[model samples]
Target: MADSEDSTTPPAVSWRAILRGTGALPPAKKTGGAPSDPALQLWRNWQANHTQVVALTRQWQRIETQLIHSVGFPQVTIRLSGEEEPKIAHSVDEIEELLADEPEAERETLIAAFDAQQKRWDEAAATLGFDAVDAELRAALDKESDFTASVPTTKAASLPGIAAKLSIVIQLGEPSPKDTEFPWPELRSALADLARLASPEAAISPL
Candidate 1:
């Protein structure tokens, strides 16, 4: 009788079957075609732009570090009115205030000096394919600006995840070398690895 009652009862619903029935399956596989959903496409575009931005940011960081380590700063001589030139104030705050007051005079001079140094640094970077990086970053920035204008300002949790992934990728691609701290070699190797991952042809391209 018990066996008969048990047999009469319907089989329990499988959790996996329930999930599949409820449309809870993993996302449909991408086939390299244009995304159908507008939101998804926007997210994808934002992801690509963010990747380039992060890469450029890392490259710029390396360049700035190298610059600071290699080039000695010019001794700033601030002529103070109080007495004895105020020991040639080197604090950024002091310089900022000084330049702020004399917009046409000291500000212009400071700007010109910065522009000259920036130009030289940019030129040096260009020689090392850094200019292309800047262009890529600019393009990414333009895309970001467009996306920002279009999207409603919402505190979406999605962006922070993508940003974090980008940060990790950049960090992994440019690991610090041991002993000798200079990472130019490591950075170049990492870039090559990234290029290879991006395209098989790049992996075998003649260096």
Candidate 2:
């Protein structure tokens, strides 16, 4: 009976799956703040413009995941060059294996679609200020004397790069990183400052 029940359990939904299932999911709960609140307004603004970036990001993620698996390289990166071939690195054997999974024509079509989608994603990210949010957060962090003192130089340098990742993770409704990898408490404190100090028109970028 236990085995039967276990076998019947559904697989967990990923963040990307949730994006795809947005229309089918229950309405999101309202977390109210005063009408004049900057963070609240910014959150609303993000909700409005994030659809394109989110969709493109999800699509690229799927392509990247498939390419990585087919190439037998977990960290393989994929990008499109203007009027040039897509940047995907693999040996002849790996390419052959990738081709075996999907016909050459279908694979080329997929890559072309991804290239167009990625350009749109880039435009949306720029217009929506995803990188700007990272800058805002990093700028806020730099002002904290105690935070600066506590964070090591190497970690401090990497914070800007990871700031966009942090934003994206939040947007995806993913769990926060463990304290061992990132100081969650410190991040929360910095966020508090960011909310309190940010201007009314502050740009809150997403991943």
Candidate 3:
């Protein structure tokens, strides 16, 4: 006969299954500068605003997560440009496959396209001394469906007289480079202002 202890034993829980369970997730703890101190509270507000500004730099949150994968960031489901509300890349190929139909010039064009949008975002926010999308590009949805806006000039003046229309697509094993410049001048200014305030906490903590 089998032992009663063996019969009553529960199956072991694999780490994978434990991770899969969201029901046991712990709640986020809300902790920041002291509630009694207005100066510390103001600094905390600046810090929170900084996070919002950074999110705009990505143009979309999912794309942001994909660009920098880490814990605390959820596993974002990347979908192609479709009727879906959110889209990171036009086609799956844009992310990895088509590898960016290019001549060195075409690659530069693509990078420049995104750079211009970044320029618009940065210069606008800097002038206002506040982060906002103003008359244009304020709505993330406006940007989400704009695949062409994200694409750079089809061809730069890499070759003297060849029109891009006449050019042939070149396939390379490597992926096209992205516009790597995401500036945070507004955030920097806020931090600088906080530094100038020279509060005791500000002096002790540099962010």
Candidate 4:
């Protein structure tokens, strides 16, 4: 469809959820009852932007998962002689989950430790070309890259107008050929970045 009128689109979706998922939803509207009252425009804009962010986020998550697993999330230990190395952590998500049930005092400590670990992970990722991959994706999402050139020009026509449902002649269009090459470079670069993250020298130990 040429617009945000998909029948499968969900109701009860939140603007905040879309924002958190992809950081691409339009900014929140504030103030009202003026020549340009934002409250008057919120619902329509919010839903359209929310759906886009959610769909993009799903694609990013799949690429990330595939890259991480492809690299076996390589990680290792770092220790001076006679100093015990900390447990290796591959994913921030896993580390955070482990701290979820802890008392605040202990959780805070754990979180700080994991934050340090994540920094190291990021550094390692940079060494492996992951930085480029990340930058490319962000640029594409921000529409700052040339990726928009790949958007298909002719999408399917909308459902025909009808007085009664059965009166409209709905022609079944053949499925369009999917682009297998689109976004492949971005995804491939991310795998290399993930490979660098698996390195040991840049490993961060939990305190």
Candidate 5:
């Protein structure tokens, strides 16, 4: 009878009970409320979109200034001489005829002419400092190769008629005067138009 009572007794409580007693359950999380102002939200979005453009413009200006300081006026010159003259053995038709006839002698002459011409061109390129100029140009181009354009990311659906209106504003900014060969004045006018288009209200309520 004593053995049966011991067998009926329950096992010890689990460690999971200790966890529950220690308040191990995750704390309740708080959710944020929706943004209050639609206009402010649009402005914030526009600012974010234009941030990259602003950075790129600054970088471009810096690069331009650096180039101006590094190199003033750039020019390339080439020189040619008779002693190193390029060989000219045959016309295009003559080569074609030689090829058709399978003439070994003519082929050898053509090969020699090609080699001489290549040598002359090489000499000319060296005399003009072509390699150095090319290197400098390449380095300058690399320095100025930050080509980035900023674009707004708000879906078109969010701003139904805004893009078309903005385009019109951009066009109006470039008003041309009669008989002007260049469009500098028109471009200046375009800036004014853009300013008007990008009015505070339009920026806030782009829709």
Candidate 6:
């Protein structure tokens, strides 16, 4: 059967594009509103910084996703000094857990082996550009924290707290074989808080 014309039709033009083509009149300028109003100025700053943080968050997520897929799971094979058989760890977390279970006197040898193997994974992550994206995300988070500090009564005062947690780089080689989680829950919450606080309806008052 032949497909309907509608099925093959291109998507309709966006309302924004249509309005632009029609040459809509420019918005009216404010007559008496004070441009130097501190509350209004703070809100504007919050809005601009929030938008940039949201964009950087998305970019960070995309790069992190690619890095995770490119370097699957990290596994390490370690041979203790006196052990006849070598130990295998699928992740650095596992190595830590293993070392914790061993006696203090015997842990040094095991730790040395683990460190050697871990260095390989760290180098691998660095070579894959994890360091670059990590730095960018940290900088954005720090900027957001600074903006949050400027507004005393803003509803998103917790933005600084959220940024502190998010800025801590969770090393890539630490995830175990079954660890498939992404750091999105707190990030989404932080973004929501920023958007709400930056909206026109939210009140920003001085202390």
Which has the greatest lDDT?
6
Tens digits of lDDT, candidate 4, 45-69: 3334445554666665665666565
Ranking by TM-score: 6, 1, 5, 4, 2, 3
Taking all chains together, the TM-score of candidate 4 against the true structure is 0.27
lDDT of each: 0.44, 0.37, 0.30, 0.35, 0.34, 0.45
Candidate 3 stretches with Cα past 4 Å from truth are: 1-101, 131-207
Model 3 residue 158 lDDT score: 16
Candidate 4: which stretches are off by over 4 Å?
A: 1-37, 74-76, 87-207
Indicate the worst ten consecutive residues by lDDT in candidate 1.
17-26
TM per candidate: 0.40, 0.23, 0.19, 0.27, 0.27, 0.40
lDDT score, candidate 2, position 87: 47
Q: Tell me the TM-score of model 3.
A: 0.19
Clashing pairs in 6: none
List runs of model 5 lying over 4 Å from the truth. Answer: 1-102, 148-189, 192-207
Kindly give the stretch of ten consecutive residues in candidate 5 with the minimal lDDT sum: 17-26
Clashing pairs in 3: 109-152
Question: CA shift at 147, candidate 4, in angstroms?
Answer: 23
191 in model 3: Cα distance from truth in Å? 38
Report the C-alpha displacement of residue 154, candidate 4, in angstroms. Answer: 35
TM-score comparison, 3 vs 4, better candidate: 4
User: lDDT tens digits, residues 1-207, model 6?
Assistant: 332322211112211111111211111123365322343344444445555666767876776676557654355566666789987887556667766756765566555656765575567667767677678778877876775566554332233222222222121122432234554444434433432343324332211
Where model 1 places Cα greater than 4 Å from the true spot, the runs are: 1-34, 72-75, 83-131, 153-207
Q: RMSD of model 6, in Å?
A: 15.3
Supply the TM-score for candidate 5: 0.27
Candidates 4 and 6 compared by TM-score, better number: 6
> Listing every candidate in turn, what is its Cα RMSD in Å to the true structure after a full C-alpha superposition?
17.3, 19.8, 26.8, 21.6, 24.3, 15.3
**Candidate 2 lDDT, 1-207, residue by residue in tens:** 112221211122212222222321112223363322232223333433455445555555565455434433422233333435544533334434444555677556545655555555555555555555545444443433332232232121122212322333343443443332344445544533332233223332211
Clashes of each: 0, 0, 1, 1, 2, 0
